[model samples]
Target: MAFSPEKSNFRSPLKGPPSPSWNDLLLKNKKALNHVLFTMHLQSRSNKQTPSSSPSPQIRKSLDFTLPSLVSDPISLLSDQILLSILSKLPDSQRNCNSLVSKRWLNLQGRLVRSIKLLDWDFLVSGRLFVRFPNLIHVDLVNGSLISLGECGCF
Candidate 1:
């Protein structure tokens, strides 16, 4: 399989099976063998994407570098299913931002809202959060100050 420049030099950070040693013999020219194995890995990954799973060229082009960096926050970098697991534990402010980040996040937020308490004595949302989550059942106002509850149907 043809290798792209990005794939030609990839190296697994692991030292174990599923990555057999036969793929890179110690006696061989170590660097060249490593490059060959890396190429194969990339080829396999590319081939694994079925037509339905592959992004269109437009989508591939529209994705910017920041998208990956934003997602690479280690906790969030976990799989989407895993990210969904901890959404409620995140600060309310973060949940709002994550909700805006992508469709995946928005979908997660929809599921997560059912389980979220939405109000913390220490972190209250007087604006959009309150407006957006109208079903918020209870909020902690202890040791908190009042601010106008903007367009969220709050008093």
Candidate 2:
């Protein structure tokens, strides 16, 4: 076979016009690409708005019964001791807010409070202090000024 450049399958490097750049190709198809993307977005939104298929009545009933038990407060499942330990780790500033969460949490937070400054002697006399903070190891009474004289000037 004769070697001929004109009939050869391969073309010379400089023979043809240069290939289009990515930017040019993308710009030319920009409107088409946008339409495709907009349709895809609408499809995704529709998919989210509606379920693909409805469950059977039996399956729905089963889910309805099981869902409540599954969704029950997970925090309530923790034991008092575990909750106390978790509460104890919180900083003093946060303890007050934690107590406000519930009566149980208030009691747990009180147990975690090891020390208290007594501002009112009536609290002690009424036994309300001990009731609120059962585990208090340190009680400050100096600030309460429990030694003030009565109207009769008696101790």
Best by lDDT: 2
User: lDDT for every model?
Assistant: 0.56, 0.72
Clashing pairs in 1: 131-152
Write the residue-wise lDDT of candidate 1 on 55-76 in tens digits: 6777655543224333333233
The estimated TM-scores of all candidates read 0.28, 0.50
TM-score of 2: 0.50
Q: Candidate 2: worst 10 consecutive residues by lDDT?
A: 65-74
lDDT of 1: 0.56
